[model samples]
Target: MNLSDYLLAQDGHDWPSLLSDWAEVLPGDFIVWIVNRLGDLVVVLPDGSVHWLDVGNGSLKRVADNREHFVSAIDEGDNANEWLAIPLVDACVASGMALGAGQCYGFKVPPMLGGAYEVSNLEPTSLAVHYGLLGQIHRQTKDLPDGTQIKFVLSP
Candidate 1:
């Protein structure tokens, strides 16, 4: 798999609408500049810093001080691989999983809910649904003790 395989910054993407679900947890104002197959985002904050929004964990990390630096940071060392979820994306493709338009790779059972990060637990899901549900779940569970029991339920 290559950059094209992981890119979610396609033509006509309405990122503001797509990223609205994350407002409760995100740091300040920003624009979703890029996204990977996992729905993880690379956003630019108003202060000119670039940050990575880790979709699964609902966490954010500053990757660079500015857009120019962000470009270098992304290509430096293993930053690209980890930030883009390249290994898992590769595995999913190898396993015949393909992400369609408006879809992303999401954990069937999220890691915060005790699920492994293995590709076997990944599936193609609507990015909006995944982010909306997981954002609420993460917000609710963010302060719970590590071993706390979470009665997870799923329904169609």
Candidate 2:
């Protein structure tokens, strides 16, 4: 599948619900592994990979953004799967590269009154595409290890 398909497959409304549900099931430390995506808390691995849990279908998609391009889930119109195409944002690539491997970049969504969802882990590829398009780059860092102890922070 491609990145666009993966993003479209996601039920935007489920972000908050998943976050609330995960907060109950996840240990406090594990919360740090969770990456906020516009209020949706996605589990991110140390390799800069992300897991999107479909609350509606109880399914999961593991995604990795390597700056150059992305692959996404495909709907075959049956019990099958195909691949979707998505391009990366250049800025996102620059940011991801700056952040180094095993790290992700975060983007802020303008505040919505009384809404819980605000920021999201910018898809590395998407960010790359954005950055590449605009020829901009953002500051980033790398420190944590795979399965390293983590703490939930409002900002990365």
Candidate 3:
């Protein structure tokens, strides 16, 4: 609803000072701090841009191309019994959606299906970059956010 509400929802991460200079570059009225826990932060701009604020390095990077793709990644992780916090990763699963198609490659046997695999390779797609950056951030901190939740209203 407002900045206080956003702060409360995000555990009061001092956003006013964090995002003060970017007022001209970022949307003003409807900024939402969607997630903040375990050192990860996510915010949704009014224009539907999803950004991941790297707490460790204090850098903000757009992790998803748009809200739709971010939501899709969340749903994919949910369906795979995984959580969508920061870094927006999909668990290693045997399905048409595994490894995000081109960003990764691996083999899966019968019982070993859906097991995690090395990211044999990477592409230039948002998904690949997200995965790569996520891995890089993860190397710094193995503890992921406590839970995954998307409270924004989905548009038609």
Task: Report the C-alpha lDDT of model 2 over 1-156, residue by residue, as the tens digit.
Answer: 423322322332233333443333323332123322221234544555545432212234654342122223223242122111122233334454333332223343211111122123343333233222222211110133434443435676
| lDDT for each residue of candidate 3 in 9-114, tens digit (9 for 90 to 100) | 3433355544454343345654555532222346777767787654323345676767777667655534212222222222222222333222222122101122
Q: Mind giving the per-residue lDDT tens digits that candidate 1 earns over 32-107?
A: 7788888888888899999898878878888899999988887899998988888888889899998887888988
TM-score to native of every candidate shown? 0.90, 0.23, 0.33
User: Candidate 3: lDDT of 63?
Assistant: 61
Cα shift from native, residue 50, model 1 (Å): 0.3
Model 3 whole-model lDDT (C-alpha atoms): 0.38
Of the candidates shown, which would achieve the greatest lDDT relative to the real structure?
Answer: 1
Alpha carbon lDDT at 58, candidate 3: 33
Per-candidate Cα RMSD to the true structure, in Å, reads 1.9, 15.9, 17.7
Give lDDT per model, in order. Answer: 0.82, 0.30, 0.38
The alpha-carbon lDDT assigned to residue 71 of candidate 3 equals: 64
Residue 51 of candidate 3: its Cα lDDT? 77
